[model samples]
Target: MAERKLNGGLKAALEYGPILAFFIGYLQLKDQVISIAGTDYSGFLVVTALFIPLMVLTTGLLWALTGSLSRMQLATVVLVVVFGGLSVWLQDERFFKMKPTMIYLLFAGVLGFGLMRGQSYLRSVMGETLPMRDEGWMILTKRIALFFLALAITNEVIWRSLSTDAWVNFKTFGLTAAMFAFFLSQGRLLQTYGIEKDKV
Candidate 1:
């Protein structure tokens, strides 16, 4: 089927619905031990397992709607499968906890490498959505790259030093909020360099 572009609200839901599911699932299952067959599993572990399929489903739906998945979205699903699979199989939450760190670091590395090459990879990814001057692209890319790097470092410290519940809370809410705030803070730059309304 040819994919049809979805409205912003629907697109956002597909992108974020899985993560929201994980948070709600964890809260409902926290502190409980459930038996499957003869093996007992913690609520957090079960939620982690469920989260993998949910993410996959949402990603699939996104592709169905848009007829394409960004490289970043594909990478995210792959990481979730690898880390979440290991977490479930090993009954260790640490593996799942490190997933965000890996994702953030990978993004930072990609952006940083582009910067080193005097390129704006972000422009390649988002140029269609937000047409702008090359200078604006470079500036935004630099800021986002640094933001991703900082998030990666923060993820490492939070997951390593904090309790599982605390880490989950940070992952579920804090990271999303941070990203939103970061992008919202960039409105002036976007407007300053964005293609004029008539030009677009």
Candidate 2:
């Protein structure tokens, strides 16, 4: 069966929905939570408490609507459940804060493994929209693997040293902008290597 085309905007929403939801929910509930919890409730804690289940539900709904979940999506769901559950169970918001770092590293490792196996799993996921030759796919996969590793390291640094709000902003917008810039820089190469419609 031919793969269904994903709407870019929908894809973006699905990818970032959890983070956005968490931020919005936290902001909305912050004062109420503080008042109820006797001023001892950290914003991060309030956010995580609400974020985890909401994310899981959102992801599941997306999967059902899409009719298929990509490997990346599957991995994300697993990680969110595991880490999010840990955060609630331990009553520590640190697990929630580190989720992005874990996700990036996990993707980096998966991409690296695919490269070692001479397969471009990243290409497999994106191939429909961004088709390319095998060589192009390999190069793209390697580059993205490295990019994910960098993101993981960057997340670690930000979360460990920066304030929670700073880290959240970086995760929500800064990192996304960086990824877009990186992809844009590769436009020329992608065009050169892209599979033509007739050829496809």
Best by TM-score: 1
lDDT of 2: 0.79
Cα-based TM-score, every candidate: 0.95, 0.86
Candidate 1 positional error at 26, Å: 0.6
Worst 10 residues of 2 by lDDT: 30-39
Q: Write the per-residue lDDT of candidate 2 for residues 1-200, one digit (tens) a residue.
A: 33455687887787788788877766676455353344456566767767767777777767766677778777877787788778766767678778888998989999999999999988878887787999999988899899999998998899899977788788777888988999998998888789996798
lDDT (tens digit, per residue) of candidate 1 on 99-147? 9999999999999999999999999999887899999999999999999
User: RMSD, model 1, all Cα superposed?
Assistant: 1.4
**Displacement of the residue 39 alpha carbon in candidate 1, Å:** 1.8
lDDT value for candidate 1? 0.93
Error of 2 at 71 (Å): 1.0
Q: Candidate 1: where is the Cα deviation over 4 Å?
A: 1-3
